[model samples]
Target: MNITISLKRRCEHVTEGTDEAGSGSLLNRIYTELYITEGQSEEVNTQHEKHIRVVLTNGVAGVGKTFSVQKFTLDWAEGLENQDVSLLILFSFRELNLIKDEQYSLLMLLHVFHPTLQKVTAEQLAVCKLLFIFDGLDESRLSLDFYNREVLSDVTQKSSVNVLLTNLIKGNLLPSALVWITSRPAAANQIPPEYVDRLTEVQGFTDAQKEEYFRRRFSDEDLSSRIISHIKTSRTLHIMCQIPVFCWITATVLDHMLTTDQRGELPKTLTDLYSHFLLVQTKRKKQKYDEGHETSPQELMEADREVLLKLGRLAFEHLEKGNIMFYQEDLEQCGLDVTEASVYSGVCTEIFKRECVIFQKTVYCFVHLSIQEFLAAVYMFHCYTNKNTKVLEDFQEKDWRYSRYSSDSSLDNFLRRAMQKSLKSENGHLDLFVRFLHGLSLETNQRLLRGLLGQTDNSPEIIQRAINNLKEMNSDKISPERSINVFHCLTEINDHSVHQEIQEFLKSENKIREETL
Candidate 1:
């Protein structure tokens, strides 16, 4: 999908006004235009002009920042755009993290990753125009000591990978080279604001673009139309379609439900949709790798339960630490081997993926942050069902007085404790995780993933208690943003009373205002 890019100038004193007009389709065109404009402005202007050297682009996960970087590099190599640059080097932080402990000169580092650059001397690099693109700063495990790292101007001087990167970004090495970095918003501050000349944000897709995506996604006009209509029916889904990955997920779930004989009511809640999506991917895996004989959804899940749970464990552990990327050791910690990880990745390629970086090392991560959150919730619920007190205690450390280990601890109380913990998060990283946790409390969703989740008390009494707890949650105790998530949790559990009450209250307030006017 084509993403919208908004540009902003980062000044020493304050951020300059955002230039929405500069937003463009291709990343290459956007950077090239800015570079060319700055070059032209330098000749005629006497005042000091900011040279567009380092551009930091921020976007949430699955918002297509990496895709834009790939497209930009491709366009440059194809000579369709940005021909002014003599060399373009792209590096992902995930790959860089593999060599974080190694020491190498900047030139040597280039040679190690891109052998074609081995013959290029420091003198040649000084004269040639170059662009260095670093993708996925959010995945970096490197300690970027930007402020305290010793300065190294010589590209041939050996230093730690972290030091080399810090110097390069600070313009102490290869000062003339243009540097571009892409990161999710959470990790964008790794590079100090003073080093960034321009800040760009990738706003995934506009409403018109969303419609265009669906139209192109399906060849059948009727199916595409129906999917689009269904998406529009839910405000939450429509807003989430702004992320291209979520659009793909929606299409995958809806398409399977519409085309198959399992024509049940269309999914309305996020949990409902994800449950169907999990089944769909499992079915696809069976069809591809197993015998041609059809099997029930429960049987398919049963076959893959071990691997999925291992993955879920991985997701849960990392979710607690606010980590999305995983290495071999991370997987090993969760009792997952490379082979098991491969099987799971093969099953749900979009949900989990393994990328072979430079050398033979591989990096693993969920396709989107939301997927990690969902799986983490599933794993946490599994722990609760199996009476895994250790995991529960670790999660609810601050609420140990709540008797989480007691047999009488209900799903409502467990979810309330999780919700409280999520509210304590300043970044709200656990918001979706808690939402998914509440969603899993519903018997409908539990039944959908019966095999994977195992047995749970999703009885009506428990479900109603959970919904009531959500309704009674004090909005004053949390930020306005988090309060909205409480409402979302209610929606996920198929409760509409809170929504109806809010609408009625708004109507009454509006009528009173009209009378006063």
Candidate 2:
């Protein structure tokens, strides 16, 4: 009804950055500092008292809710008539997973409070007017820890859910009076109803806003004009901009796509847009060869290439292997560097570097979806036991019927070839080894083995090399128990298959009996 309501709606229009719309993310700061939360002038500051401003802003992810919230907090704080009393404290629920206990949550608040107030009491927080921006309800803690280990207990309120709800309703952690709870509707439903205000969902950017965005990305005025005109007339482009993030993604993608693919047509959907983006990235890499510039992200890519190719080599050896999720920390022992932040190539590396690789739970597959499929398909090909020639041919040869699989199959095939090239060490990524894999538990290492190559019985031809390596690991270096563990992981994928060869293989090797017994 008022500007605050209007402000909430306007926030949805932004795809990038602002206090309300962002978690103050440094990555790809869209910085859309435009949202007005009505003339809540009286609401926020009643008769110059500065009514505890509980600013509730909510919208879908990538809709820029955090960005708007951040902008509002800074602006409101700057505009405040009184400096000492009015303060904006920003908190994110995502970070609480590390310490989910109520006392710990209070400790976090007290700690933050102490930094500013210098031994200020928690009781004092209520007396003073404070502006708090609690963000990322959707990403809150599912569990908590004590002494740095997830102190798992059957306590419900002791659970992350209770800690958050208690703080909002009873604890009044942001008790400064004004609390803004922002979340997507689905996520908003998660928070206790008593504290949060009426639900407000941001309705993304308008057509004119998208046009302006595209104009900014494009340097050429004429090109920008023509593009906007084309987008307005085009059915797909007009439909795509219904949300802010999509608009930004579309604009960013289209800017690059139209330039390289300038000769032909424009991409319609996000999929085509991604394909074009990948292609542009591919082209950007190719520029090195033409100009002969040696160092680039390609160096990192080349090393990554080797590991993926080795993974493919291992996978083709074991396609009928059980399970798909490969835990990386377990895959690379000496345990991924145990810190709070891992160094990343970005602007905020310094702030986040100390805590890197504390990833006991962070599992990753290949970089892209297409690459994962490529590895799967490559592994499937080597599994001679899966003699469904049609399925094998479907993945490998790409005959007429196979061609009908999906357009994405080509991209999958693309990664396969890329890895295959790297495997040969002909192009891309010279370092084929994942140094971490050597340190995994014999159990996990055996599992990765199974992921690459099937059990001993239905094993594929390409996996012969890997099999030889496992045999060497078993006989020459390791103990018998570890070798048997690996053997179990591979063959267990089809312990009950129809193949008599496999049945006999399992029986003679005693693999099935080992796990079951």
Candidate 3:
């Protein structure tokens, strides 16, 4: 088989921004710019040379790095883009981790993954144009250990995968082959700066791309236009749309609510949006049952609430451990069977895809990381409002888990502890949760959750305390990004009057005294 034929793979759900040559994206230019070999005449080889040997693409989670890599590789293989590249070999570190300790010759590595390559000579590797695309260095469990690993020149030499990877990256193996690596910014640092020829960051979607996405997503022109206009009108929502995954979530929630003619205002805050989406999914499932004329085992609405709380607990516990992927055991611990869990497949997403990883068994995760965070917040809200301890039966102390109905003092204590924990959390993982806690305390959101959960009267004292905490956090010592997020969180729960009050207080001479409070 031809190398290009052997390499052909489908690109799935790739969006508009990857190929567009916009001036804002330096990353696109770096990838598209063609380079020729130094010794060849410009006429003969100018288009054939691959400019950068190693391009490091960095982005936050859910910014579509994997999608872009798949799209690029497929485009090349299909002769739609980068025709100079004769072969593309793609590997994800998540899959690579399974064989990290194994030793293999370069040929063996290719053959194991792509048996069709066996007919090709190992010598062809050195002469043929090859592109190595490594996705998700952040997911890799193996230590690259660039400093400690010994380099090997021979491609056929046996070594651990990381050593082989280090050698290949350092130009000790297949020095001329083009390599591309994708990682989260934090993980991108693992590769030495000297070894990388080009660095690019995928900043998700631009405003034009966001417009294009909605236009493509919704066939109803008026509805699509309305959604676009709504997103543009909300400054917070517009900023969130820059992330493709967040855009998908927003589109999903808005599309359903709009189409169904749901009453009340569209959700503005992250918590409100996620809650609306969950309710939409539940109503959808209820409609399916109504259409089927089938007798469901439990009340469709009641089951929805039950499943959400269970899933929220699962999300919270797993997030605490920094575990995004879950196995059967994890689901079992949450009192969920595969069949029962599948009911949440629409909203929670089946993160436990069996086909993608080395684990033959299925794994589960939230559709997006933010969903997990939102669900975690929901779990916290449910616990505080209802005094539900079933979710926290494993914990011995329940000091902070008091019901909001318990007493003013208890609710105040819980909010203080929660805010303190959120402010101190590394990476702001709990930021959304904190926001949700505040948002859920609102009379509007509480009314929305009325039957699904117990009532949590919004406390003026707690709100004031939380506002003060945010003001303190916005101090110079805190990161500007964190301060900005704090501002967003305050907007979600506080009254408009409070926003102006905080703004005035921030500018006042008493700012230091307010910060002390």
lDDT per prediction?
0.76, 0.40, 0.67
| Per-residue alpha-carbon lDDT of candidate 1 for residues 1-517, written as tens digits (9 for 90 to 100) | 1111111110111100112112124333322111111122122322324677888888777777766776676666665779899888878888888889988998988888776666789899999998999999988889898897499999999989999988998899998999999988778878887777777788788887888888876889999999999989997788888877788789888888787666468887898888887888777766531232343656777877888888899999998886888998998889888775455443556467766768988788876788888888889998888878788878985547435456447788889789878888887888889989988888778877777787777778888888888777755767898889998998898888888999999999999999999
Off by over 4 Å in 3: 1-3, 12-51, 100-106, 192-194, 288-301, 327-363, 383-419, 422-426, 449-457, 495-517
* CA error at residue 245 for candidate 2, angstroms: 3.1
lDDT of 2 by residue, 20-51 (tens): 22333332244543323333322232333333
Model number with the top lDDT: 1
**Evaluation by lDDT, superior candidate among 2 and 3:** 3
Q: After TM-score superposition, what is the CA distance of residue 254 in candidate 3 from its true location, in Å?
A: 1.6
User: What lDDT tens digits, residue by residue, belong to model 3 across residues 1-517?
Assistant: 6556655533432332212211122223222211111232222213323666777888776777876786677668668898787678887776676687789877778777766677766688889888888898866667898896587888778889888889888778998888999987656668877677777778888788888878877889999999999998776789888777788778878897677645668777777887666666555555642232222212443656766777888888876665555666887898877676454454334222223454453445565667777777777777766666555333223553434354533544555566666666556666666777777767666665554556654567766766676666667866666676678777777545546776797788587778889
The number of the candidate with the highest TM-score is: 1
Judge candidate 2 against the unseen true structure and give its global Cα lDDT, from 0 to 1: 0.40
TM-score against truth, every candidate: 0.84, 0.47, 0.76
* Model 3 lDDT, full chain set: 0.67
